[model samples]
Target: MRWPAKLPAGTLNRSIMSAMDVFPTLAEAAGVEIDSPFELNGRSLWKALRDGKREPRKDWLMFASETPIRGHFNVTAFNDEWKLVQEIDQGLLGADVRTHLFQIEPDPNEHNNVAAAHPDVVEEIGEAIHRWRMLYPVSGTRHELVPPPGWRAPKDWAGYPVAVGDLQDEPAPGMPPPFALPTLDWQHGEAGRLIYDCEPYAFLGGGLCK
Candidate 1:
């Protein structure tokens, strides 16, 4: 398959390729030839891509990464002197989640005239959303919600909004200053989900997944 064009920045680098090579090697190192296509979950590979790491292509199935720490954060809690020590235990998860949205866009050529094209793309995107909802059925229901001190919500809790914003743009009204969802490789995952769901002719390989 042609790789997704909109793959995250570090996805194709040599370091990632090398890391990918390790999966098969490790199996050999352990004297076990896992003859099947090396199957890994999508999230794991994506994490490797984000971290400038890679893994051998196994027969990967679509699933989220198990890692608890996958993304970036700012230590704003430290600003309150009394909370400085307490803040050490707090940090965000899934920095990769932040980049999930920018990967897809309405075709520029169809810009004001996308009404004809929007229907199919919208349906496809909606199905992806549904699958994600089915896969992860929990929620925190906010743009940001602070956890009790020394605690954090499940990583997938706040992820849906990010996912939705990535697939479709919907602005909340009367919500202080305007906010834009931080753009990332949203389409890659979205398209991958479509492929997983057996959407016919779905283009999983392109600038979006590469």
Candidate 2:
């Protein structure tokens, strides 16, 4: 991301951002307007970066990070000062789940479990993560320890189940006519048949299709 004409050279920044920030950041940096049906989970960091400022990003006080890890779900919420962790959590188990807290700025290595010391913080982040997780559609993906019986990985690209010919050559049933491809695309914007039409909601939040 070298742009000597704009940003300073060889500098350190402790700004916290997520993978979701990339699109808006690059779009803004490239001077593009984002017109879409849903709001973006991440805002552009270009201004802060160019001006060498330490302005916290929108919703910087808290963020919920959830992903599948180690055959289970790794859920966490963090701010500049604190991070709350719930490892191997699938959200099915109620009170059985245990939480761990850390003053991340001081304990970057996470060598201490300050959950008992900061029950209030734990509860705050716990509720945040819960609300965030619950926002996903009911039919969203679950943490599967392993594929179901008889499921086998494709040995090669040629053997992939959804090969080129397996797809429809024509647009979806109610899609616009072939002559309107470009117009249809403009209307749809970034949303397409990708991920069965939900866009990146499972991770970045915000479903496609207004």
Candidate 1 TM-score to native: 0.22
TM-score of each: 0.22, 0.59
lDDT score of residue 74 within candidate 1: 17
For model 2, the stretches where C-alpha displacement exceeds 4 angstroms are 57-72, 88-95, 137-145, 148-210
lDDT of 2: 0.60
Model 1: runs farther than 4 Å from truth?
A: 1-39, 43-116, 138-145, 148-210
Candidate 1 residue 198 C-alpha distance from true site, Å: 52
- Across 178-200, the per-residue lDDT of candidate 1 in tens digits comes to 22111112323232221122223
113: Cα error in model 2, Å: 1.4
Candidate 2 TM-score over all chains jointly: 0.59
lDDT of each: 0.30, 0.60
Q: What is the lDDT of residue 79 in candidate 2?
A: 65
